[model samples]
Target: MADVARIAGVSSQTVSRVSNGFPGVNEETRQRVLSAMKELRYRPNSAARALKRGEFRTIGVITFTLSTTGNVRTLEAIATSAAQEGYAVTLLPVAVPTQDEVRGAFSRLGELAIDAAIVIMEVHLLDEARLSLPPHVKVVVADSDAGDRYTVVDTDQAGGTHDAVNHLLGLGHATVWHLAGPEESYAAQRRTGAWRAALEEAGQVPPPLVRGDWSAESGYHAGLLLAERPDCTAIFAANDQMALGLLRALNERGRKVPEDVSVVGFDDIAESSSFQPPLTTVHQDFAEVGRRCVEGVLHHVRENGLEHGTALVPTKLVVRASTAPPPRKVIPCS
Candidate 1:
């Protein structure tokens, strides 16, 4: 600070105003200070500035697994949005989704220099670990149903699932089968429930649910079972990854997509449109979810009070080559 001020021919207070982006320093003066800073390669002490402002200007992100497409995309968006807001993001991945692991992650993040936290609650562990979070740290949850207890920002899981199922049903399919993700996942549960409700609302009996571990391999196994059922003309997989495996399985079994069997999937991933036949799936606004999460937490931090509610980002149904009217049954000559 002293060196930069001396070089810029200004008092330390003037340099501080320039470094902190405080208005009052003339444009030429600010330019001189910046030039001096650049020459000396001087960077302001963020830690000291944070102390004075009573804020770290950093947000901590805690997530269960980055393996899933949604989590990975949401995390990327959060990082980008935080940077736009002049805040840095610190990521802490919890190996296990247990209460103990979640609590530990919160404790570790509390010890760090973060003004708030955004938790990607793929599972229900947050419900059990809520009380363990630091009182001073504002928190916003994503992809969970505990909105009544904590502020949450998430994709409209049920709405997307409803749209996916209804699209299939609207195609004149008798009934749409579901290939669900892991049972414990909040997203999977919401999607599965929505699928069932959508079918029932159409006066169609819901078919048996096939469970998958959110892996393509699991989807392949589930597909094998559904392929043998001639009545299963249309299917909705919980995610695009599973839908990819289902497509391969159906192809191997000689079931032509949108000809013999139509498929709809959630999470319109990047490769979805490039699938062999292209995928008809629900599109989640991961970037918007991430942006809202950061915005929600920062709002609480600025207000100095934690607010609890749910903010849902809308989803879109992308129709592609994978979905169409079910095959017309051929009748033999009497």
Candidate 2:
């Protein structure tokens, strides 16, 4: 800051204001300060800035995996929002959240002087440890039922699944088969429930559940299994990656999409459109969810208190070539 101030011929306070994005600073001055900052390669000290601002202006993100399309999208949104808000983000990955890992993360978070934390929702194993974080540490859980104690920002996973299955059934398909994600995922369970309910509501017999780990490979394997069944027609995979695999498996067996088997996937990932046949999938507003979570936490932090409620972001189904009517005859197994 001092170097920037010297180079820009401005006071340290002016540099601080510019760095913190305080609004009263003139455009010219802000630009000059920024230029000086660039020329000198000056960086703001987040810890010192936190001390001055009386809030760390830092948020910790806890997520089990960034490997999935949905998780990555959500995290990207969160980071973008945090940056816009002049907050730094620290991403922490815990493939499996053990008590020790959770404890260690919280301890490290405490030492970082972060103002709040936002944890991506995991269906299981994280709640007990998450609950143990200091009450004063503001937290917002994303896409999980953390109850009334923790603010949650989530998409309508169940609702979206219901809509998808309902769409498939409305197309005159007898019953929709499900390829669910890993058992522990909240999304997988919620989607499974919605799929089953849609079937039950129509008085149709639901097919047995097939399990996958939210991977293209897993979806392919599950697809192979479904392809062997003569009755298989309309199928809904838990996510797009799996759906892609299913598409491959069906193709390999000489089954035509929509014409032979209709499919719907979750998380309309970026490449869904470019797939061999554009994928029909659910679209989640991750940016909206991330912004809401940040605002919710900031609201609590500003009030010197907290209130916990869940934010359920809406989802839409994008129908594409991947889904269509059943074939006239049951396709023989290749």
Candidate 3:
């Protein structure tokens, strides 16, 4: 430190400020300190600095998997938002969805150097370990039903699903068939409930449900079943990838989209617009959800308090070429 200070012709405190990324050091002087450190090959020890500051300003993100679109996008958003807030994100992935695995992640978190945590998995395990953490640990939950036990930030899953179902009904389809995600996902459950509610609101009976694992393969098989049904005029998939597979199945079965079978999907991912006929789907503000999660953690850390309530981000329907009024009835020859 002294060597760099002497070379840069600046005090050790000025050099320290530039290295730690603290403000109040002007640009020219900061540049000089950085040059000196580069020339001397001096590296600041982050752990020692964090101890001196009494806070790591890092958030631990505990999640299960990144195989799905929602998980990956949400995590990316969290990292971006955390960086904007002058903090860093560390991922703690749980290999399995078991309660023991979730609990073990949180247990290991206690030994980590993070000042806060943003949990991105099922809250059933978190609920079970409510009192496991010390009083200083602050938490923000994403994509789970924590039930007011923790600050929650998530998309408007139910409302988006309801809009999707009702959109098909409004376009003259008698009923919309649903291809749902796995039973274990809270997001899938919310969408399923909303689909049922939308049908009941319009005084129509919902068709039977087909379950999928949020994959194109699952959706392809489910599409085959729907293809066999003559009255399957409209289908709503839980995600865009499933919609892609469903579209492929419908095409192979000679069912023309919007001409014979209209389709709607949730999560208007980037590639959705380039699908064979393009997709008409719901758009979720995943970036906004991530930003709110970081904000929730920051609020708790800075204010010495947390809001034990769920924060909802809005969603909307994005109409495209894939949906239209149900196909006209064909007149039978006498």
**Each prediction's whole-model lDDT (CA):** 0.89, 0.85, 0.87
lDDT-based ranking: 1, 3, 2
Model 3, span 169-194: residue lDDT tens? 99999888999988878898889889
Q: Write the per-residue lDDT of candidate 1 for residues 128-215, one digit (tens) a residue.
A: 6443455555899898887888888889999998898888888898889999999888999999899989999999889888999888
**lDDT of model 2, residue 20:** 70
lDDT per residue as tens, model 2, 60-102? 9888787877788888888998899878898888767666676
TM-score of each: 0.95, 0.87, 0.91
Error of 2 at 94 (Å): 2.1
Give the 10-residue window scoring lowest on summed lDDT in candidate 1. Answer: 126-135
Error of 1 at 163 (Å): 1.1
For each candidate in turn, give its C-alpha RMSD to the true structure in angstroms.
2.6, 3.6, 3.1
Q: Candidate 2: give the clashing pairs.
A: none
- lDDT for 67 (candidate 1): 93
**Model 2: lDDT to the true structure:** 0.85
Which ranges in model 1 have alpha carbons more than 4 Å from their true place?
A: 126-132, 330-334
